[model samples]
Target: MYVAVKGGERAIEASYRLLDAARRGDPAVPELQVGQLQQQMRLLVDRVMAEASLHDPELAALALKQAQGDAIEAVFLLRAYRSTLPRFGYGEPLDTARMRASRRICAVFKDVPGGQVLGATHDYTQRLLDFGLLCPDAGHAVIQAASGAPVPDAMPSALAALAAEGLIEPQRPSAGDPEPPDITRVPPSYPLPRTARLQMLARGDEGWVLGMAYSTQRGYANTHPFAGEVRVGHVPVEIVPDELGFPIEIGEVELTECQMINQFTGSADVAPQFTRGYGLAFGRSERKTMAVSLVDRVMRADEFGEDRTSPSQDQEFVLPHSDNVEASGFVQHLKLPHYVTFESELQLIRALREAWDARTTVPPRSVEPSTKEVCAK
Candidate 1:
C-alpha cells in the first residue's frame, strides 16, 4: 500500500533555506537595512509595534525583516520575542492633558487651543498615485520651519467643554489606589471592564477593529459618534520605585489618543447626556485609536443599560476573536495532519451507505439454497 504523507525533516529544512534565499531576492541588489525600514517605513514599524504590544521600534524593524514585510507576522515575531524578556515595574497611567503634541485635531470645534496642528497627515491627499515617487528624490517633501511664536504647551480637551456644560457625562476621579489592569499578566474573562477592553483593542488586529467599528456606523448597535478630539504626541512615563516612595519620569513615548462623544439616553437621576468613548495607543496610530474608541462605546452597551443584541456589543464574541495571534494559530492549524480523524469519518460514511443499500435493495431470494434443500429433503 502506498501511503501518502508530507515531506520529512530534510524537506522542511530545504523549504526554510529556499524561503531565506527568496527573501533576499537578487544578490546584485543590496539587502534592505533595518535602519532603512525603521526610518523610511515608519508607519509599518508603528503598526507592528502597536499590534505586538511592544514599543521597541528597533525590534519591530528586525521582526519586519525576518517576516519579509508581513505586518502580522512581524507582530507575531515581536510578541514572541517580548515574552522572553524580564518584567520591569509598571508605569503610572498616562495623562494626555500634559502631552507635548506633534499633531492635534478636533472635529467638534473648528478651532481648538493648539490651532489644530496638522502634522504629517494624508487626510486631504488625493487617492491618485504620483508616479513621480518611483524616483528616490521625488519621495522627499520640502522641509520649511515656521518662523513664529511658539504654540501653547498644553491644550484644553474638547471633552472638557461639553462636560462643563452638563451635556456629556462627568469625568470622575479614581476612587481608592487602584492599579491599572494588566492583560499580559492575567487572562481576560467575561464582562470585561473598560480598561481590559481598551487594552485588548489597542493590541488587536487593525482590520478586525476597523471592521467592528464600521459595523456600528452601518447600524449594528448604532450610536452616532463625533470625533471630539484626536491627538498624537509624546508623554512622559512615570514609575514609582519600590525603594523610593515618590514617582520619577523614566522616559517618554509617542501616543495617539482619541475621544469620542456619542448620542445621549436619559438616565433616572440625570438628564440625557452624551456618552464618551476613549482610546489610547502607542505610536501615531490614529486609525487604531479611532476604531478602539468606537468599539469601546459599543462594548459598554450593557453598562449603559442598552440592548446587547449585536455582535460588536457581545463581549464574548469580540474579546476572544480580537486577538489576531490566537485566531490565526487556530485557523492555520487546519493544515496540520487530520488523516486519522478523516479516515474514521470515511469509514462511518461507507458503513452508513452500505446499511442504506441493504435496507432498500431486496436481496435475491436464496433460490439455489432452496433448490438444494428441496433435493436433499
Candidate 2:
C-alpha cells in the first residue's frame, strides 16, 4: 500500500477556516458587536491601545473584533494598521495638570486637597463569581436623580503641594538652548536622557514594568517610594497647524499619570532632598504608570547617591528589556528552525561515544610476547 505525505499549506488553510468558524460560533447566538465590545470591555480596549500606542478607540475595537478578543494579537493588528496611516502632524505635549480626572488617589496623605476621588475602580469589588450575570432575569434598575453636586475642577498635584510647603526641592525644567531628545525617532543611548526614559516607560510592557516596580518594594532597592499621586482621565492633544502657525485641538487621549516621591539618603556635604519619579502613559493604566514611576526612581541611583547593585539600577538591563513586543518576538523566533544545529551536535556526541568505547575495549598488540616465543624456538 502506498500513502501520500501531506504538506503544511493545506493544514494552514484548514486552520484559518476553523479559526473563522470558532470565532463566529452559533448562528442563533447574536454576534458580539464592536460597539458592545468597546463599551463593555473598555479596560481591555484601553490596555490594547496603551501598549499598541494608537489612540483611536474605534480602530482598537475593530482590531479586537478581528483578533477574536486576543489582546496581544489585537495590539499587533492595531500597530500594523497604525503604521500604514499617514502622519499629518505631531500633537502637542498633553498637559496632565489639565486632565479631566475620573479617578485620583494619593497614598502619602490621609486626606488630600482633592479628597481621593475613587471614581471607577474594581479595587473594592468582591472577587466571588457572579453566576446571576448569566441569567437573563438578572435585571438592573436605573436611577434618575436631580443634579445636586457640582463636579470639582482640577486641583494642585501633591508634588506641587510639597514644593509649595518647602518640604521637597524644586525641579527646574532645562533652561537655555537645550533640545530634549526624541525617543520615538532615535534609539536610546546611556546614560539615558530623561526624555528617552519617559518615552520608554510610556510604551513599556505593563506586566514586566509592574514586576520591576514591585521589586523595589521587596527590597531590591532601599528607596521608600510613596504614591504621591495617581490620576486617570482624558487630556486634549493639540497640533500646530502649519498654515495657521498656532496650536489647534486635534483630538483627545485618555491617560494615566503617577508621580512618586522617594526618600533620598544624602551623602556627606550634601543636604538630603526628596527626589521625584514620574510616569505617564497613554490610557487609564494606573498600575503601569505606578510601576514606571518606581522603575524611574530605581533607575536614578547614581544621582540619588546609591550603589547600582540591583537589577533595577542597571539602566542597560531595565530599559532594554522593558519592551514586550521586541522580547516576545525574539524569544518566539527560537521555535522556527534549529534542526541543522541540533544534527551537528548529535554527530559530535556519537563520534565521542564511539571513540570512548574503542579505547576501552581494544588492547595494544603483544609484540614482546611474539619476540620471546621466537627466541625460545
Candidate 3:
C-alpha cells in the first residue's frame, strides 16, 4: 500500500526553476542590476573581489547576482571565472605611494605630509536602525561641505619614509637567485616563502583572518603591533607588452595596504631594530589588510626576537588554513554519503558489547586448588 516515489529529476529541475524565480522576484519591481549592486552593495562587492583575488568590480557584481547575494558563493563564482583568465604577464610591484588614495591614515603620525583622509568611511555613523528609511514617504536631503579643493600629489609611503630615516627595519630584496614558490601551482610547505604567505592572506576569508589576528591580541602570542599605515585606493597596474618590450598601462585595480610596526626585543649582542609587518590585498579591504598585517607580525616572532610558542606565530598554521575554498569544500564534503564508515563502527560497538555481556554473565569458574596444595597432594 506504499505510494511509489517518482519524478526525482523533474522535482530537482522544478526546484531550480523556483529558485531562479525567487532570485528574480517580480518583474514589476525592476530587477537588481549589476551597477546597482556595485554602487549600493559596495562593501559586499569589495569583499567578494578581495577574497576572489580578482580586482574587477563588474565581475564581482555579476558573481553576486548569480549567487543570489551570498558573499561566499559570489567569491567562489568570481574565483572560478578568474581561473579561466589567461595570465598575460606579471606587473611591476605596486607602488603604494603612487596610489590615487580614497582613504589613508597613519596611527603613528598625526601630521604627516598627506594629512589623514578619512574619505567615505562608516566609522563615525551611529549604529541605530533608521525606521524612517523604511517609510515609503521618506525624502532625501542634501548637505553641503566645502568642495573644489585640488587633489594633493601622492605622498611618500609611510614605510618608505621610516626606512629612509633608518628608524625601521628595511626589507632587502630576496637573497641570491632563489626561485619563489608559486602558491597557485604548488602546495605551500613549511617555512613558506613570503610571496606564498602574501598570496594566502590576500585571498583568505576575512572573518577567518580576523579571528586568527584577534587570537594574537588575546595573549596567544607576544605581539605588540601598531598600525603604522592603512591605505585604500586605485593603483595602476602596468605590464610590459611582449612585442612592444616597453611597459604599457594595462588597467587599474583597487587595493588596500597595511603596514604595521612591531617592537623588537633583540637577543643579547643583537642590536634592537623596529620590525615591519606588511599586508596587501586586491580590492578595497582595510579590515583584511589590517588583520593580515597583524598576523604577519605575529608570524615574524623568530626573526624579530620573540618566542614562537603560539599557533598564530606559526606560518604553517596560518597559511594552510586561511583559504575559504579549501576549508568549505572539505567541510561540505562531509555532508555527503558516509554510511559505510558508520556501519563499520556500529558493527565494532555491537561486537564489543556482546563480548562484555558474555564475560560478565558467566559465573566465575570455581577456584582451582592452589598449586601448592595440588603439589602436596
- Candidate with the greatest TM-score versus the true structure: 1
- The TM-score values for the models, in the order shown, are 0.90, 0.85, 0.86
- Give the Cα error of residue 45 in candidate 2, in Å: 1.1
**Over 4 Å off in model 1, which ranges?**
1-7, 144-151, 173-178, 359-377
Instruction: Provide the RMSD of all predictions against the true structure, rounded to 1 decimal.
Output: 5.5, 5.3, 6.1
Model 3, position 106: C-alpha lDDT score: 90
Q: What is the lDDT of residue 299 in candidate 1?
A: 88
Could you give candidate 3's per-residue lDDT for residues 225-309 as a string of tens digits? 8989898888888888779988888788888899989878667865676787789987668888999988888876666557788
Clashing residue pairs in candidate 2 (N, C-alpha, C atoms within 3 angstroms): none
Indicate the TM-score of model 2: 0.85
- lDDT assessment of candidate 1: 0.85
lDDT of model 2 at residue 51?
A: 78
RMSD of 1: 5.5
Candidate lDDT values, in order: 0.85, 0.79, 0.81
Best by lDDT: 1
Residue 11, candidate 2: C-alpha displacement in angstroms: 2.7
What lDDT score is found at residue 41 in candidate 2? 81
Compared with the true structure, what per-residue lDDT tens digits does model 1 show for residues 1-377? 22246556666779799999989999998899999998888888999999899999999999999999988889889999999999877788788898988888899888665687778888989999888878776644554444344556787786777777999987664356355578988887777777778889999999999999989999998789999899998899999999998899988988999988898777776589898888888888999899999999988886677888789898888878988988888897787768898999999999999999989998777645677788989
How far is 203's C-alpha from truth in model 2 (Å)?
A: 1.7
